[model samples]
Target: MEQLFTLAGIAIGSSGLSAIVVAILNHHWAKKKNSSGKLDALVEAQKVLMIDRVRYLGSSYIHDGEIALEDKENLAEMYQAYKALGGNGHLSTVMAEVERLPVAEKR
Candidate 1:
């Protein structure tokens, strides 16, 4: 009877430990998932901001009918980043237009 009680105690202890481990793993997974979601949101927001800046710069250059070499370089960098962040082809068209513009001479 004593051995039976010992075995029961061990079984109970093992079950409790298993439950605790499962709980900890679940909590860790939930935290990681939440962090991933936040990161995705941040990336999407950054992509939008990049798109806006690219459009603004591209439009400015296109409207002016010329882009300074420095401005063109900067715009190219911005457009590259925007494209890296999954920006659409519409901006590609705008960038092409900007690319065709004459380079302005520095005063």
Candidate 2:
């Protein structure tokens, strides 16, 4: 009877340990998956910011030809960043259209 109780206790302890090991592994895998997704989300956010900046700059240029030197540099940087992050060609198209628009004097 004493040996049977000891065997049963060992079995229960091992079962609990197995469950803990499985939990830890599951948590690690989940964290790994989330890390990849989080990076993608961050890149997507950067793309959105750059795209908006490009649009705003393009519109300002089209309306008034009022882009400052700093803004022009920023537009170029944003375009490069957008392209690096898998942006479509919409920004290039918009910029081309803006270029074709007649320049206006700044108010």
Candidate 3:
């Protein structure tokens, strides 16, 4: 009877320890997942902002019918970054149009 009680006690302790370990691991994973989701959201926001900037600048330059060399260089850098962030082909068309615009001579 004493041996049976000892075995039961050991089983209960082991199960309790297991439950605590599982709880800790679950908390850690949940925190990690939340952080990963936040990072993804931030990256998506950045991509959207970059796309908007590229579209605005490209459209403005196209409408003006000319772009300054310095401005064109800046636009090119922006476009490159946009592409790096997985921008689609729509901007590619706009960028091509911008490239065709005449460069304005500096005063």
| Counted clashes in each candidate structure | 0, 0, 0
* Model 1 per-residue lDDT at 63: 90
In candidate 3, what are the lDDT values of residues 1-107, reduced to their tens digit? 99999999999999999999999999999999999999989878888888788889989989999999999999899888877877667588888999999999789
The RMSD (Cα, Å) of candidate 3 is 1.9
For model 2, the superposed segments whose C-alpha errors exceed 4 Å read 1-23, 66-70, 98-107
Candidates' TM-scores?
Answer: 0.90, 0.62, 0.83
Sequence-dependent TM-score of model 1:
0.90
Q: For residue 12, what is the lDDT in candidate 2? A: 100
Candidate 1 accuracy as lDDT:
0.90
Minimal lDDT window, size 10, model 2: 97-106
* Root-mean-square deviation of Cα positions for candidate 2 versus the true structure, in angstroms: 4.6
> RMSD of each candidate?
1.4, 4.6, 1.9
Candidate 1 residue lDDT tens string, 1-107: 99999999999999999999999999999999999999989988998888888888899889999999999999899888877877677588888998899999999
lDDT for each candidate structure: 0.90, 0.81, 0.90
Q: Model 1: residues >4 Å from true position, as ranges?
A: none
Candidate 3 Cα errors over 4 Å, as ranges: 1-7
lDDT of 2 by residue, 1-107 (tens): 99999999999999999999999999999999999999999999988988888898788787775555555666777788899889998798767756566534445
Q: What clash pairs does model 2 have?
A: none
